[model samples]
Target: MEILKKSQSGSFESSDIIILIEPVEPNSGRNIDIDSSVMLEYGDTIKALITSKLDSYNISDIHLIAKDKGALELTINARLETAIKRACNIQKATMH
Candidate 1:
């Protein structure tokens, strides 16, 4: 999983799960639904989903910084996956 250059820090560790969250408006994308806007209070739900998705991997440390663009749960998930893949340096996953 340490395929990419160790970001400014050192080797990636799975024990570390860094999460940064920011608030955003709604209607940022076509895939995003306004009803899912309940993410404000349900942010932990998104975190849990992403964590679950990354749980099976060999990633020891994960640093997830999210910029909410008024998107829904699905959009958030897509963006998070993109970020994680980018962090791990998966060349093919960067097609986004």
Candidate 2:
């Protein structure tokens, strides 16, 4: 889904991550930045996870800022997905 506006998810709490995303010009490519307490140990891993998640959504033109506080993979996944949904103007899933 296309990013309609800037959106954020998660928190600065321990073992959590905050994901902030902003819309960029079409076809401009992704600008994924990472800030983590474990940067020296898992920087590449975090970047890969974020890149894979963005790719899954086919989001090529966005500026994503991931601030991590030693969160696990699952948390990262969830936060990023939630941020994407919010940026796309989705409040919640609809049920039929």
Candidate 3:
């Protein structure tokens, strides 16, 4: 999905991450900027995870910033997914 405007999700709580996203020109490509409290070792892993998720959603040509506050992989994934969906105006599915 193409991101239409700036959008964000998550909180600054102890074990959460905040994701900010904005649409960019298609030719500009995807740019991911990550600031993590545990960048010493897990930086690449975190970046890879984010990239994979974006790819899974077929999202390119966007600027994404993830601010991590010692969150786990699951938390990061959820936040990023929420932010992307919001930016793309994709509604969450409801269960019967």
The whole-model lDDT of each prediction reads 0.43, 0.91, 0.88
For candidate 3, what is the TM-score? Answer: 0.91
- Per-residue lDDT tens digits for candidate 3, residues 1-96, read 789878889998888899999999887889999998888888898999899999999987899998898899999898888888888888478321
**Shift of residue 57 alpha carbon in model 3, Å:** 0.8
Give per-residue CA lDDT, model 2, range 1-96, as digits (tens): 689999999999999999999999998888888999999999999999998998898888899999999999999999988899888887686321
Whole-structure CA lDDT of model 1: 0.43
Best by lDDT: 2
Candidate order, lDDT descending: 2, 3, 1
Candidate 1: list runs displaced more than 4 Å: 3-40, 93-96
Q: Estimate the TM-score of every prediction.
A: 0.49, 0.92, 0.91
Q: Model 2 misses residue 57 by how many Å?
A: 0.5
TM-score attained by model 2: 0.92
- Residue clash pairs of candidate 3: none
Model 2 ranges off by over 4 Å: 94-96
Clashes of 2: 0
Model 1: which residue pairs collide?
13-60, 13-61, 14-60, 14-61, 15-60, 25-70
Error of 3 at 20 (Å): 0.3
